[model samples]
Target: MMFEGFLFVIHLFLHTYCQLQVVAQCFINLLRWWRVNKWNADIFLNQTKNLGKIPGHVSLMFLEEDTPVEDIVKPIVWCICLGVTTISLYDYYGRLRSKKLDIDKELREYYSDFTKNCRNSPKNQPSPRIQFVSVENGRTDLVYAARDIAQDLLNGVVKEVTKVNYQNYHKVFRNDHPDLMMKFGIHTTLAGYPPWPVHLTEIISLPTCHMISPYNFLDCLNRYFKIEKRVGK
Candidate 1:
């Protein structure tokens, strides 16, 4: 069991480390190579060019230095990944332990025990609603990034509520979630317009993917802007 737990830890950390690296790489690339004309977006280049080939040999151009060396120098990526995995493992373990404890608790012996289902019934569902205050669909990546940033603002609590003001939630979403770009259902290269995806149908059918759920607000907005942009092009 301990060995299994250790392996789980290693896996979780590596995953997060990889994710961070990917996010960092994509962000840098977007700032540099992803511009309208492959512009030299060298914001960091000017800041650290004088630092020399030390301090893990970090580079502003493409982080090419440390990544290759990390593979040899104790495999830093793996270490970081392991660390992330350890935290995830502990969190899951704690939750499981709590659930097990709850299950093991002795029932009220001499009193009538009533078990109540905690789930919200059909009537408790949020009304079928779509609120799109704004939409921008120039690039799916940009839209995806915005959605991620918006979602993160709620810090997972957004999963339960409605009505969002970006001021309160922008930090949580920011560039943290690259996976959100994946949620748009297609990877759009900047060369030209990407082929229309069938998933757009679901968006068009009712302007939402998950019934009356609010998760698709920004998602739909993204598509809306993308469509308009394509038409304007």
Candidate 2:
């Protein structure tokens, strides 16, 4: 009985000792982290490199800290004043040179003051609306495509062109009027095909083996008649 009692006391002391050692290690690790994090705050605040200059054109919202109101206001003011000032200056000069309005020193000064007022006025910046036109919606491109479709038809004006020259027509057409080209359908492969266009496959393959190249030669398409003229004349 005495030996058993003695073993129990020794086991209790070893368990308590192990638990205390674990707690002490935990406190040491906690203390190290606390010091590291505290020092990191100071290191970040003093790091004055890329933080000062923002990337790209100014976006309203991305920043590490609350941005100074002045930073946002200044560029907006510059852009607004510069835009109005340029228009006003152009008008003022144009009127003077064209003799449309009698230009006096007072009028020039008044124009400058008006531009200044427009910049300093702070009514929340309005969003600029942008409108876009696509190649499929352009005027000149549509008209050019229409003209080309009829060019080989009826008139017999220019040499009948092969489908391979589609892009060639498009390039020249766009160069003359690019703004309208973007509004019309620039590319359409099967759009203008006639009901009998598939039969042109036979003419293209010669022996009607398969696949057509260069141009579809449907017998029904009047354009095919030009093949003889094109080869000879």
Tens digits of lDDT, candidate 2, 1-233: 99999999999999999999999989966764453233321232233222232111111111112222222222223223222111111111122233313323433343343334343332343532111122222345557766876775667754565655544554222211111000011232222222121222212112221121112212212232333422223
Q: Over the stretch 1-233, how does candidate 1's per-residue lDDT look in tens digits?
A: 99999999999999999999999988865643332122111321232234332121110111121222111211111112112111000111123223333322421110011112212112232322111111122245356646766666668645543334432433222212111111111222221212221112212222111111112322332443354322223
Q: Considering every candidate listed, which one attains the maximal TM-score?
A: 2
Residue-level error in angstroms, candidate 2, position 28: 0.8
User: Which 10 residues in a row give candidate 2 its minimum summed lDDT?
Assistant: 175-184
* Model 2 misplacement above 4 A: 41-233
List where candidate 1 sits over 4 angstroms from the true fold: 34-233
TM-score of 1: 0.17
* Residue pairs with backbone atoms closer than 3 Å in model 1 (clashes): 12-85, 13-81, 13-84, 13-85, 14-81, 14-82, 149-173, 149-174, 153-169
